[model samples]
Target chain A: MTGPRETLVGITDVVKHFAGGGNVLKREKRKVHAVNGVTLAIRQGESFCLVGESGCGKSTLARTVIGLNAPTAGTITYRGQRIDDLTPKAMAPYRRRMQMVFQNPYASLNPRMTVQTILEEPIRFHFPRLSRAEVKAKVEEVMLSVGNDPHWGSRYPHEFSGGQRQRISIARALMVDPEFVVADEPISALDVSIQAQVLNVMMDARDQRDLTYLFITHDLSVVEHFGSRVGVMYLGTVCELAETKALFANPRHPYTQILLAAIPRLDASGFRHTRLAGEVPTAMDLPSGCVFHPRCPHANARCKAEIPALKDQPDGTAIACHGIEEGRI
Target chain B: MALLDVSNLNVEFPTRHGTLHALRDVSFTLDKGERLGIVGESGAGKSLAAFAIINLLSKPGRISGGTITFEGQDLTAMDTDALRSIRGNRISMIFQDPMMTLNPVLTIGTQMVETLQAHRRISHAEAKRIAIAKLREVTIPSPEERFDSYPHELSGGMRQRVVIAIALLTDPSIIIADEPTTALDVTIQAEIMALMLDLCETHDVGLILITHDLGVVSEVTQRVNVMYAGRVIETGSTRDIIDAPKHPYTRGLIAALPQQNEAAQRLNQIPGSMPSLDGIPPGCAFNPRCPHVGERCRREIPALRALGEQQVACHSAEEVAALAGNGGSAS
Candidate 1:
């Protein structure tokens, strides 16, 4: 199963921390590490997924990748070039190479604007020299590329349903023809009957355009279905990374195993179930050593004190757990 | 004994054009300790079916015609006075969004105490004590501390837990959960569902869960009913509905799901969107979108045809049944 290096995007120990608010006169300053020591890579045209509960740094990592939030530490390299080193003004040219599709369609789209303006605005920013007629034509082309009817360009956001509006958002994201896209929970906000339709359209767009995706979601089942590579995040750190099949079939980390087991299998419903007893610990005060030790069923004294590094397993899967490192499980 | 029995229920809504028929001839019985899952796409009348049973349909929505018998009593004939007595005391409901069941301004403890006081005569201190115990029953951590917290302070998952705690406080004989976990992530969805199943079994309560998610239905429910535009197109045991669905619409939906283990260049999806309930197609509401639709299906609406323990409502039941058994792609 040896494949090409094919690394399109590389994240090297990225750390994004948000400063906490307090009295400046006589108070201590705290930092909430939204994403800590996160490192993963997406292949040229692979669907890389991140799965975890809320507040697990999944969205933080996605935001950091698309430049919505800058990394407080670490580096991000794109196509063998350092992206984190670029200034915001100098990063404008590189922005066309990467784009992001957000989760909420209502908040993402401006209610006052038509679909035409939403799609054209991106192209206007990237290629400002294009004439008015050319911009109109390009808007139609991009809209059609994402399966939105070109006629829909005139429709306002209020006229369309959730799925249709999301398509418009996709059109806006793909207008620049970016090689890499981060779709953050794109299908999560739609009705079940329409979720697959949106997923199919996005898959088609990805293949047609050779777009690499960083799909972030909390549902492991969707990751198993769509992601070529999967990473399990917990408490601001990546705990496991492997091919989708490898992660689901033979999950090495205890947190990932429980996450997978909790997704009720279609055939083995009710028969095989492990309801995690305790709630996810507060992310503000993370557990020491292994962040997942408090929830890990296989946790030991070693796991409680030492932060497990993401090391490659003999089977090629990357797991961050002391139990697996010590051959305890 | 059957805890809830809804017979030949029909609900209609007043609209600009005409009366919009929602649920039709929907008859379902739940024993004292039974788990039934009503599943269908949006606007498929699953939610209305639940609402009609408990007389919860408000305003433009009304149970125009129906006989709702709960615990051997006729609920349809009861006035607001009688209905209010049974609404939260004997039967409770949990909605998809936790905010629907909770008040934003009130503390969790106040809301719980108020709900308890609505049915039972108790002191405020006693009500607070019972509320704290109920919160603990739903597995809420630090109930003593959380009782003072507002709904906005809790996370989405925690808020849902509070909703469940309120729903279970009265120990209702029947609990109708309408897409309770749809707003949750899959991992949390499973945990909440497992908790509900245990609670039901422990309290000997009959459960009616309404959802558009088939995966959740097939997991948590014992029996399943597949609804179309506004009709129960198929009804049977959960095993029969998942392993051997009868109606064309049901089969199409099952096939449309992108299974985890299946390999395909493209995901299988139902070709067209759900037909608007404003005015459904000619005979079969699904005839326009149905792949196996025929002359009989387009001309005559079918009744529930019996097939062993399962019942199907389609003109081409035999053909659909045979196709379901043969395991051919439907959509």
Candidate 2:
């Protein structure tokens, strides 16, 4: 195992933008700024979470980091080396070190392929030099590591339950022995009972493999429970970053506070649904100054004109809200 | 009067191997203007219970036994032809997938108008006008513009709001919303819950909300029913279910959820898989996974015993609650 001090992934000022069009021939470009200027780091064995609403660029950032979609600007360096500029030939090695587990296990795996074939395909591609017997042994070990019975490999993805397919997906990710894994909403598409089982299995595997995770999800409860530190994003910007305790206990940002209040909580009497205003704003046409200013209950005139950059606080956390910065609330 | 009374309702789907009992001896009473939250894990038959009330279960799935009385009308015995008139005009429903309740090619206006026309003999123009007003009643953003948009054109939240608007078109006496906001984000979910709660109060409609979310049920429902493996394992006021859950399954679910408190070392996830439909254990369905299982629990399926306003079906309910630190005597 590598030293715990190793920097598994370093993402610096990563930006991703997609251009759609009204006029195909006239070349009208309507750019949707998905992940604009995101930067964070993941140590060798820490769990990091990127949390936001459905359209707030969490998934885009995950894809950008895993090299699925190339970023529009900035650098993605794994273990202190840049690979965005490299050709496909040079990028092949990086692919083996980083694998992604998608949200929908039903669609993520090949519908026709057996779980055994899915696991073996990665092992075959990443370790072409290994003999057939060695590849089969490695695949079985990977399956066992993910808490799936080795015999389950013969079953198709449909034959297994949602939780089991997720295990298969995780097994496929581990078959390559990736140092950094991007788990994108892995538990969202599961039953609550099944969700618990899958989460436990993932945690156990993370421990044994010493894997670095870029855990992307919309569920703040899971994020607080599992993430070592978290970055709360809104409108393609990191609004807040802090240790799990500091963030949940004394959230510095107004958006972060709103999100926390919005989640349903159970007390003796019943569920307390925090009454926040309106729906999430369309990212294409966000507010002029602060992305969260329109929704922030503590917004002022100053928030409407000047954008707040992430500023340090006495507590070891970073927040980018004018209200937090000026102590307005 | 209790606006809705369900007694010994059992739903079954005829599979090749055997008849799968999706619901078993389910019983509950919902008074007028009351919100009854049904909470359970997936496949716990929470949604199936809701569907059964509407007589909307698919082919091969039929009501095996019992009755549902709405304002003294035998809902279980009413044929589909007789049911259709009262179904939308009096009792409406919303689904977890908002799209399932909506037609894709039809504009929001066309759909609402058709629903209005089916029950009330109104002119086409009058129907359109009422549809617009109903749309506004549900607080859809720019209802006029949204009335023209198809289901596909609107966002998930908007579609759900429109679905609620359709449900409220006739001022239904009862509304069964099956996980309405389970698809939406937190902010939007809160908005939807508040909207539904307000509408239910204004109309004095009995609302039977089917959901697995403890938080969702607790926020709006006056009463809560905890289901497990196709049985209503526990029933009480929301306070009792949340603060003084008696059944081990209820306690297990509460413990499993991640609380907001930052001091948690780990979530207490309930172990063992939910027994498959065909593999339900004979005694307590939750016996294998329940932390407080005893000898009697594995031998006999306990009947729901009366305890104040709450009802629980567990042989060791008292002992389990005490051990689980409920800090109160089981009634």
Candidate 3:
């Protein structure tokens, strides 16, 4: 536990673009730039949170990292080995080491499958040599770890409440004992009380199993509580990356500042929020230089013409804004 | 007289098995130009209370008992023609989804003009002028150009701005917004809430905000009513409720927030989930999850009783408030 932590997943300049908006007669096609030129590293046993608006492509990047959607470019390395381009058979081992949890538990878990069957299917597919009794023992252990009753394994997903179903979803992800887990908005669909329960379950699983996470969510409050490090995404680009405390205390990028200022805290009132001028531009028709330049208040002529690259600050935070580099912000 | 008063409001849906009580004995009053927030979980009947105020409950769901008094008139007893004038003119509604509220085919300007002309005897040109001015009031950029654009042409935030403009078009005395910004991003939601607050204050319009987000409720509303199961368990000033809640359920709700906890610490999660409407527990609906539950809680339902500056429907409100002196929890 005291060893030097190493980078578990190294993502370099990843890009994902989808072909969208074609016509039957006019034959017009446009590229929806979902995740573009995002570079980040997930260290061992750290919960790296990616936060942004709905269309900011944070989910797209998470899906791309897990190989659910193939990246249009760039490389994803797992423990100094390139695994993004591996074939199905070759990628099977890496898949066992990495698992994903989706946003909606209602849709993620199969209604027809019992808890035992759902937990056992992954083990059977990954390691066919394991006996039924061994698989059952593993399922019971994981179920109990997540606070679900092992005796209720015969019940279906619908029998459990939403919070219990989400716990089951976490248990399913841990079935493979993956070293890394990518949970995309795991608690967004839950109530406030239930959200805490699910988040606690995830935190406990991380501590007990020594797991690393790439948690994606739009909620800044949850990120403040759960994230070790945070990356703020705007139009598929990482605008700011820092420790959660640093990000919340002193957000450097203009977009990050606006995003943080908009969160309605319980301690403050009177409807005060920093006003951003315009709405987020569509990804299909992104701005020329910086994707956020159209809405950024600190944007200048250079910002409109040249894209800003992520520059490291002396305090270890990375910001992608010309204004920050020029001391204008 | 109060601008709007709801007393002993009960809404129910008659199902084949039995009648499902969606809301029970909910009572609150909204003064002129005042903002009241109705906060609870999803199935706590916050939206149903709002829907019942305007006689807009969907099929089979009706107001079983209560009085919705608007300007000294009982809205529940009013005829369709009398209520029609009050629905969008005296009091208007802003739904959660802007796309659902705005007609997809109709342009923004047309919807605004139609809404204005429905109640007032105004010409098309005068109505168009008022529509554009209302749009400008909401700070929609280039109101003239946006008026001509269809609902699909604008972004989500812009569409909500247009919805707010329409709600304000008739110069209504009160606006009932039910989770109006829940579909938008946080940044957009903040802007919208601020804009609504500004308009409500400047125009002297009462607001009844229904949402599940406690932070937004605390920031935008002066008073809040905490609903659980079907009843309003706690009602008090927003500051009082946020600073020191009386009800155990309300305390648990405030403590459950991620912001209330230390960084990376486990949140103060309530033990059980909210019961379904069909299978509501007897006595206090929150007795199963209440930390201060007693034998009396399971035997009889608690009614709203005055407790210094607030009204709470919990038998152990005094003990709970004393135990958790501040911050609602051990955190």
Candidate 4:
């Protein structure tokens, strides 16, 4: 809800391909086309959400933006500065500014380490010269901010519940007071009630710390409640980008429409969803033009041959579909 | 008599520490072709109730009390051999994970044929024919081709379709699907749910759908049983319970959903996590997290009593309903 937006993270035509172990009998070399030419920006103090099914490269794109994985092609800029090509030593300062919270808190947290050590490890790694007392104070402050009791710091992760463990993970992320956070399905592992607690914690931290978020999740409801801007990704490419309300109210892309229609609403009178014809194709063997064209009902010959560019609309939304461009859908 | 009537079903696990009651006084009735949803968070014993109905609880976890009367026969009193006859033949189950439910090495055809032949006196050729027909019923494309494919060869959605097809092979009167679509994507989940609902209606099969997602339950179920801490806190028609939940926990659960509240606003979270079964609180298990907790709630366990169309087990159900009517949080 902040005004005068300034770009915090700028991703320009980024492509990340993993070298797939091709069929041994055929002896063919191929790359898993994970993220193919995605461009977007996370403005200052806004929650930018990426929604898609499994293996859609939302995670890969988040990782690429946060410098976890270098892009196979294109550039990732932090505050207009190129951080993609920087060395690990050179990327230290950026790492301190950018933090990540993963989906599963149980697996992300070490079983042996106490909560104190887990929260303290990040501070120690990022700020090596900080005193022990300073780090402890910071940990206590972060834990309190995230609604985790400081007394429970002595207990191991297993002692705490899933919600508490997730709060601890969020606390660890905020220990550095990061300007940007890439939370990949942070609350998906918890129950609905617990999910609310974690979401509130993240929202509170964002407000208090003035943080920008790149939230990746498959659950559209969370995106609607949490995100300011939403990007609908399908088969490693973002098909549509719009403000959260605009995306939900008036979805442009056929994929986005189907995805929105698929959500089982509590208010829905009956079970109804747009059933797509085909399942997600393997990343190793992507279709000719649009990855979704095979399954898309509105796909024409142009959609089968040429990849559509992201076209800006008057309503402040971007869509990448030939059907939308030609007024066919 | 109801098609399947479970009265005061108590399931327990005899651990070394003590006997932990996993499901306490869990009672519900599933009429012919009725779609009943058992909704709860994990460890709330919704799944345990489903397992208890079929006498499929694992070792140490057994149905300690109450009667599961199906077709005027007590399933709880039946021996293993007798129960085995009805376990899959009369009441089939579809588990959460389709991959785990199906055999990895065997082709889909072999597994389906074996299951059908085991329960019914049918030839292998007949079983195969029936299996393919069932596959076609579930909308699996090219049923013949898919029958020869292994479990791993199919996608997650296709495998779930296969699982549903296998569950329908015997023409069972009842189907217990525990989180049937929880493992799939939202789109796939919607498709599977639609197919399941369609099949149940057409075949006139009773369904006991156990899931954590209230949205799914609201969409798919005719009646819902809201379980909390091993007990059915509320039971009513889907519309009534979802629209005006009488129980504080039920209200909180519905309000806690992101869509229920304003976008970007703080969700109405029920404070604290679900109590573990072994250390469930005395009196009311939900007292710790409930907003409308009173002295009576902390001292005495409320019985499920009828309040109009809904049966709610809360000391302050009337108060909750009144406040909920005013668009209040019921605090």
Using Cα atoms with residue i matched to residue i, what is each candidate's TM-score against the true structure? Answer: 0.92, 0.92, 0.98, 0.99
User: Which candidate tops TM-score?
Assistant: 4
lDDT of 3 by residue, B1-331 (tens): 8989999999999999999999999999999999999999989999898879999999899899999999999999999999999999999999999999999999998899899989999999999999999999999888889889999999999999999999999899999999999999999999999999999999999999999899998899999999999899999999888888889988988888988999998888899899999888888999999888999999899999999899999999999878667535654
| Residue lDDT tens for model 4, A21-59 | 688789888899999999998899999999999989999
Task: For residues B119-148, write the lDDT of model 1, one tens digit per residue.
Answer: 999999999999999889888899999999
lDDT of 1 at B72: 84
Candidate 4: where is the Cα deviation over 4 Å? B328-331
Error of 3 at B321 (Å): 1.2
Worst 10 residues of 1 chain B by lDDT: B258-267
Give model 3's share of reference contacts.
0.81
Predicted complex 1: CAPRI docking category:
acceptable
lDDT digits (tens) for residues A1-329 of candidate 1: 13755798889999988987445786768678789899888789888999998889999999888788889999888887888878988889778989888898988999999888888988999999999999888888877776678988788998887878888898888888899989999988876657777888888887788788999998776787788889999989999999888887888788887787777555655624666656677666778999988877788898899999999887878989888888898
Instruction: State the DockQ of every prediction.
Output: 0.44, 0.45, 0.84, 0.86
The C-alpha lDDT values of all candidates are 0.84, 0.84, 0.92, 0.92
Poorly placed runs, candidate 2 (over 4 Å):
A1-7, A21-27, A131-137, A268-278, A300-302, B260-264, B294-299, B307-309, B326-331
